[model samples]
Structures are given as structure tokens and as C-alpha cells.
Target: MLDDRQTRTEKLAGEIADAILEGTLEPGSRLDEHMLAGRYGTSRTPVREALRQLATTGLIELRPRRGAIVAKVTSEQLEMLFIAMGELEATCARLSAMSMTPIERRRLGAHYDQMGEMVAQDDVPAYTAANTALHAMFYAGAHNPVLSEMTAGLRRRLAPFRRAQFRAPGRLARSHAEHGAVVRAVLAGDAASAHAAMLHHVSLVEDAFEQLAGAPAGTAPEAARMKAG
Candidate 1:
């Protein structure tokens, strides 16, 4: 029951995050728990939990006496977050290139192959979920528990922005191509190349999000509806 409740909270958090990213919930807008519970058709319990979780992500701000409001982030702040995240991810790729077991490398390869099918089908949601899995594998293959924990935490915070990039036209194929570079370098044990490729890939991700954020209001298609991290 606890696990199920946790899942519901996480799901609600993702939905609310998506609305913020898509401009449905503008920055600095109040997030009333009661209203949100009604909007998402859940009780106040999960709605409250979801708001608390999103607060950690800097997506929403919680006040003492007041309720929550969407946190207003500047472009520079967003860039800095992506910079930190990209650097950590690059380091993980570098270490994995040097240390991952042969079997682990093969598994990464197989996972990449599966993602290719997702791209071919133009299945944005599947591709995004697989993208998160691929990064998780890279983090685990690095074999540093502390690094993995920190990286994954930041990733959860960046989930809404990172996943929103795929909604851009042709971004799925481009992202796959970028991952191809990182995968090849990791499989071949090229630490330098893997690091460089992963860094470059994340930089592009930041750019994609920026472009998506600037689009006209209400132009967004229905979000693929998957959790980012």
C-alpha cells in the first residue's frame, strides 16, 4: 500500500511538473492543494505529497502560512543546473568506459538497439522512458555509489525539462544519434570520447529545452505522459 501511494504521489508530481513546463501553470502561480486535488481527481493527501516532492526539484516553492507557487527560474539559473548535471553525467560515462564489465557493456548495447526500434516507430514516450533507463545504466555501470546518488537526485529535479525536449519535432531521432556516439565510445572503452560525447549530448538537451520553452502558448501537443527519472 505504501508503494502504491508513493507511485500515485510521484505520478501526480510529474503531471503537475508537466503543466508547469508546458505553460499551463505559469510561474509564480499559486498551487492550491485542494484545487489541485480536484484538478487531478485525487485526494488532498497525494496532492500535498506531490507538492512537497516537487519543492525539492525547485519547480515549486512552499511558504510557511501560504500554500505553494511555481518557482520562477531565470534562463541563467536553468543553464547552470544543466551545466552541473551534464558534467556529472559526463564523468559517469568516463568511469563506465574505463570500468564497466563486458556483460554490462553488452547490456547497454542491447538496450540501445531496442531504443532504435522506438525511434523508428516515432514513439516519443517509449523513447523518453528508454532514454531515462539508458542513463540509469550508465550511472550504475560507473560503480560509484556516491556519484550515482548525487547524479540521480539532480536528474529527478531536471526530469520535467529533460523529458520535455522530446516533444520537439525530430528530436527523438537526433537524441538517438547523440546516444549512439556515447554508446559506441563507452563500449569501445574510450573514456575521453565517451566523456566528450556525453557532455555534448547533454548540452544539446539543454538547447532543446530552451527552444521548447520559447514556443507560443498552447502550441504544445499533449505531453507523452511519462515520468522523467
Candidate 2:
């Protein structure tokens, strides 16, 4: 069925994205469709679709003659992307604090609780799915369609890196704690606090990713200071 094919394509895309984030597929490495198809035990159609989808996330580049290659994301580019994503998410959190109804807030809280359970069980994949849902709830709670769309777009672009952060030791617990801060602030209708909490949470995510990637540790402290302030 068409739905099955789509699901397979998405699964393949996520696998490829994970490989890139884990450094198994280094930046600038060529991705041969036929090779991937053989490796994944799938047809070339799904492989091609998966690569095209990855291209949309800026994780891979599909060239006319050269096929697909991993996109090189420089440190500066990563920093800028995180900054933009953080600000946008913070803004959404602030708006959500001001706008989310009681029922919506409760739903978000319930989702967070589920994420907590996932974390306690050390279920990274489940936690990641719950984390994504929690964020989607925040976006939806903002009640601003345009803002939600923009945030969703940025989130997609950062998906691989954000998912990679979970691989860091103790990151799940820390991430859950950060989410608690945001949840409490939102439930209390404290816009400023919600914004700060989200901003700090996003910054910490960037730091976790950097640590995983063996990058230099310079921006994390500043982000921590912001969280403290």
C-alpha cells in the first residue's frame, strides 16, 4: 500500500539521519542509493524518497550528477540554528503560558508525566516521541498558526541533532528536569519564566549535542548563566 511505502521511507530517513548524527555517515560522504537499498534490504524507490526527505531537513544534499551527500554543518551554522530555534521555542512557550486553556495545560502536563515515566524506564525512543509530542503541544497551545508553523519547520531541521543529544549520558534526566521547569511555569501562567525555561532548555540541548560530537565547550557556560539568571 501507499501508506506502507511512506512509512518505510520515513523509517529509512530516520535511520540515515541517525547515522549522520552519530558520525557513521560523515559530512560530505556520498550516499549511493543502490548501496543503501542493498544495505537496508529495500528497493531503490524508498531509498530515493528517503534521501529527498532528508534533503528537505538540510541533513543531506541531492545533487544532479553526484547523487546525495551529507550536508556539512559548520560550528557557526549550528550555533546560529540553535539560537534561532531557541528564541522561537521560547516565544512559543511564552505565548502558550499566556494563552493555553486549562484543559490544554493539563494535557501538556499529562504528556510530560508520560515522558517522565519513559525517562525512568530508560526508554530513549519512547521518551523522544513523548518529547516531540510535548513540544507540539506547546506549539499548539500558542494559538498562533504562523508561529506554530515556523517552529515546526525549525524543529524538523534540527531533528537529527536534537535526537542525537539524547545519546549523551544523563541527558534524558536533565532534559526531563528542564521540561518540568517549563511545564510548571506554563501551568502557573508565568510567561517570562516559561520563556526563560524554554530558552535554557534549548541551549542545554545544543550543549549536549556539542559534547556528543566532541566539539569545544565555550557557549554552554553562557547558556547556563542565562538559565541561572
- Best of the candidates, lDDT: 1
Q: For residues 1-229, what per-residue lDDT tens digits would candidate 2 score against the true structure? A: 9999888998899898877765567778899988999988999999999999889778889898999998876666678889999999999999999999999998998888888889989999889888998999999999999999999999988887888788889999999999999999999999999999999999999888877666333322222223223
Task: Report the Cα RMSD per candidate.
Answer: 4.5, 5.1
| Lowest lDDT block of 10, candidate 1 | 220-229
Clashing pairs for model 2 are none
User: 66-95 in candidate 1: lDDT tens per residue?
Assistant: 789888766666777899999999999999
Error of 2 at 99 (Å): 0.5
The CA lDDT of each predicted structure is 0.87, 0.87
Per the 3 Å backbone cut-off, how many clashing residue pairs does candidate 1 have?
Answer: 0
Q: Name model 1 segments beyond 4 Å from true.
A: 218-229
How far out, in Å, is residue 121 in model 1? 2.0
Per-model clash counts, in order, read 0, 0
**Model 2 / residue 25 / CA error / Å:** 1.8
